[model samples]
Target: MSQPQAAVGAAVPRVDARLRVTGRAKYAADNSPDGVVHAVIVDSSVGRGRVTGIDTRAAEGQTGVLKVISHLNAPELPPVEGGFPPGEPLRPFQDDRVRFFGQPVAVVLATTLEVAQHAASLVEVAYDAEPVSTDISVADPADEPETYARGDADGALDSAPVRLDLTYRMARNHHNPIEPAGIVARWDGDRLTVWEKTQDVQGTVATLSGEFGIPPDRVRVISPFVGGGFGSAARAWVHSVIAALAAREVKRPVKLVLTRRQLYFGVGYRPAYEYDLRLGASRQGRLTASAHDIRTENSRYERHSEGVLQPGRMLYSTPNVRQAYRHVPLDVSTPWFMRGPGYSTASYAIESAMDELAHELSLDPLKLRLRNEPADDESSGRPFSTRRLRECYLAGAREFGWHRRNPKPRSTRDGDWLIGMGMAAGVYDTERSEAHASVRLDADGTALVQSSASDMGPGTATSMTQVASDALGLTMRQVTFRLGDSLMPPAPGHHGSRTMASVGSAVQDGCDKLREQAISLAVRDEDSPLYGADAADIVVRGGRLYVKDEPTRGETYQRLLARNNRSHLEAIGSYAGASESEKFSFYAYAATFAEVAVDARLGLVRVRRMVGVYDAARIINPRLADSQAIGAMTGGIGQALLEHTVTDHRDGRIVNANLADYLVPTHADMPDMKAIYIEGEDYEADPIGVKGLGEIVIVGVAPAIANAVFNATGRRIRELPITPEALL
Candidate 1:
């Protein structure tokens, strides 16, 4: 808590904000390797089929057409592999069998992007088509769902004085980042180097090495900057491999980017959900029992399901609970993680149901939630490293003017709009994994810190640099922090908001060790100031070592190193020992508040304002954290009101594959937004004690807006993107 420490609970500006604002940052697509040739993929026209043959004569004959690589002439790759046993591995053009619609069948490399695109249309494909199952409702359900029970729910629900049963459905959504998913690959002899848009560079390298039967070291992956991932780039997809294959076949570097339409199938998305909830409560609105039945879509070749029921299992202190979660298998592309994935979906149902209970019991929603707040994690019975959900509500309500709520449907009206306010609680796990960093001190006294962590528009590089500077007693300008190449020290993948807790710890460790080395050298030198001071009593400031109680008596690191005739000092700091299992029970909590205006005639709903109060522990950079929290809240608005993926089902294909057809929120759609950060520490989680804020910022957003809609117009609509037709 000291002023000069630069420790936890301070709002610091991001060190790299200027680079991004000045347009100096570089993303994956920005890398233009010399001799790079553009490549375009050709996808299957049918939904499902067996490719009888491929005719590439016309495409191969075009000018600047290096070659058309398909199953016929494509070099053999190791069979696709999956870490999860039940899921199918994505095999790009490995055989004649086509699993789903728009699966890539071939790649055409050309001198220009337009030329390759034109050539891709010329290639001909013939297939024996088969009927496909795209709709989960029409498909047969799994015989038995994964069931977890604590107490009898049927009897409790029947006997309780208050009860509610409801179902919520959500549509598939795409991760449409500003920069399209693409890759640039170059082949040097048998080794391949790729500049790709990905969340996990190491995961990409390992997968590519396995696919090509090459050593992992031979494959290098770089993704320094990302436009916005939203979990789409969590793992390597087929497009990266397609580019590498094209480069190998053409004997030239290839730059392949998925077309907007191709992205629908090239990557994965959040699977659709249908959730049924049954709840029982006491007359005083203290909860009793709950039962949940949920089903999500997956591919016949793979089993995919989110931990969607997790929030319900622990968020509230319900007594008797029974839950059944099942995945309905269909012939469709497997789903991957999305922003707030499981937490967002589950919160919408549970929180909305809580709102309805409050109304039925004639009690305020905030009071109802406070009544059921658990002292510890109910599911695990572990004391929380920190639980601020109640604090988030109390503080948020005061800041958001919760007392001013009209508390009556359609009671507060402004001309043609019905105005109302609502709020909901949010939660997400504070995940951690093994990470490592290397710190090097040069003769000139400048320090270099390297890690494999990436900045996906979240200012990761900037925050990590701040960590190194503070720990090593160096000014921000003297420490250079580098990230994004697999060659750097290891780091956890940027997901689940774990980057800071995992990678920041690594940085702190590396810098602390490096600082210790400097101190040791300074103490041993007879020419250094305070030569006989105890090592533990020496503190560093501005790259200088001094006795703890005095400021004037100090020796610069450069002076000590030069007097000792040493060139440079180095150390490897690893926080890989920090894992989720041992450290602590960590999670970030948020309270989302929303105010909306509804049109009685048009059924148009416009969110007028939103406030998100978060308890994410120590914030490294207030400026960047504010932007992230607001951006996530804006994105959550889209999830609650505007975004939804459409499917053609007839041919088992996504209908709105492009951005234009698949609507996302633009600047005009955003409302007045505010983000509040709570200052605290949980040293048990990591050295930095910083819990994740990225995912939790949007966790409870949808439910808040949905509850607001009900308040504005006495209507309880459970499904997502609560459309005009439903209210009208």
Candidate 2:
């Protein structure tokens, strides 16, 4: 008999690929509850102000208009509980104050979307406008900045033989997913149900329950599909709350979908940053000390913070390091995590500075990095669970043809284009959180597994099915996995790249337990074949239980259950997550290499190719991993050369609110891209031996492209989106 193939390491197609291609998949906006009415928000014209008057008589008189609700007539909601970032969260239609541009001031509900939209426009709102501070450079920073220090950075910089001081400016970026944010909400008496475009369904439920002054069990959020959520959908924004409120007031289901224009301010964005870096290294390119001062934009109401200081403290072996991160309040909506979040922003500065030092020392950029590889995490003083960054560098360099590149800028020219090669290292935390999964094996020789985790375009369902198939020793076709319902066993939110490490592990545990239960029953049964055999020696494959050394002595699960008059086996698997006092530092590592061509006359920078080697431990699905890597690389290319969110400081309005004006990389802009994963396992990081992959792929991409531009032009552009004017 042929041995059954394991599904875990195989390149399996996504289980939902057919559903997506056939248009059977249902996203948040696709849900249409019975008797659903449409709602359109009337946004504020002023950036900062208080609403003095609202004339809704014209909107209320419109045909099919059910009601026009604003802060003037809206009921008071319960105070929000446990707001994030240690400040007040924006509540829609709850107050008269307009905190930022496009703040929702009124909601128009009608029988159809067109009527609601038209009515929303008819509503007139008068604001007492106030001066706005939207530019980070002109705004004052927080009174106290978050500070960290390991040694005397000032003393080291003063004594070092070589030093470089650089300042970088990064424009704000929006998520701009293919599908805009939407919600379908219904209130059945005291219980509420909602279908929302969110990365965390349970988190949305909690937020709604708190605001409505209802019990947790009274709220249910269902979101089976997400078009694409970089990080904007991780939390329940105020729009979701507004939808629910409208449903209750109108006594019918309400559907609210943000238009393309509304998405600019309706959802969160990646805030702009001004990073100032000073590094001191030896003449031979060995690091001595570094200091980083970072200021990023935030809203005056909510103080947003992230892991911006982590990379500066631990990415290298620098002994003396000082870091200060401050938030500059602006008249805008709060910013949230976008792609790699803080690590990507910091890497651009740190890695670019490293490349500059390499050039100053007349050394290979790759070699200079190799010289400062850390044995342990310098920030936490903990050994690494698996730091294969050196291997990544060596493998990436070999694959990307690093040895053939000339050191001097502008030396290699391809006719009108100046060709150059550059590389940078990337890292992100191997974050894990408590999770649970429920598994049930039926007598029909099939299994079902479930969790509350979300997919968010990483193929979570497919990967979890693969893990379950391997753990249960069943064929991939016989196992089914389901997610995105609050009723399923609890799991962590599908952000931070923790879905695989946390939810996948729980699925494996659940499947293993069910398989073991069946084995125990078969061994103890007198009527079963191989009775009294050692349970330890028993293994299940292709839904058949057999002795490991004697494959012929086996029985099908279907027959065994039939003979024993059994129905099914079930188990709930759980993982308690990482310990706070763990001894090892856990992170996913990558070495990204890029090749670019610069048109000096037009000041254009075009990427020719990119290669990324990652050490993310075990990969459940290579196909899915490659998709993540390539997509992130594309986004990075946009960040390096095109994408930017322009703000009008005059009134705190986003200048380029639509895609036509705000640029992203097109198909023509993308070039050859490759992703290679190192073969290994990191058991210390999680039970599945898998570190996170999604965020790390994008961490160092911007820096790699930026470094390549410098190599081609011999001009250091410290700002992001190395624009044509900047290159010229």
Q: Give the top-scoring candidate (TM-score).
A: 2
- For 74-117, candidate 2 gives per-residue lDDT tens digits of 98998875766679989878889999999999999999999999
Most lDDT-accurate candidate: 2
After superposing candidate 2 on the true structure, give the runs of residues whose Cα lies further than 4 Å from its correct spot: 1-5
Residue range with the least summed lDDT across 10 consecutive positions in model 1? 1-10
Candidate 1 wrongly placed segments (more than 4 Å): 1-3, 7-13, 21-23, 80-86, 577-584
| Backbone clashes in model 1 | 0
Clashing pairs in 1: none
The whole-model C-alpha lDDT of candidate 1 against the native structure comes to 0.84
1-728 in candidate 1: lDDT tens per residue? 11146533346666666777798977777778788899888998877878898998898888988888888887778765655426667666778888888888888889988888889899999999998888866787788798878778889999999999988888777778777898899999988899988888888888889888899999999988877888888888878888888888878888887777877887788888888999999999988999999988887776766668888888888888899998888777778888887888888889999999999998999999999998877777787899888889988898899999977877888999988898999999888888889999887778899888877778887788788878877777888888889999878788888898998998888878888878777777777887777878888778877887877889887887787787888888787645545534567899999999999899898999999999998888787798888888888888888888887777777888888878787898789999987768778788888888889998999899999999999998888888899999
> TM-scores for all candidates?
0.97, 0.99
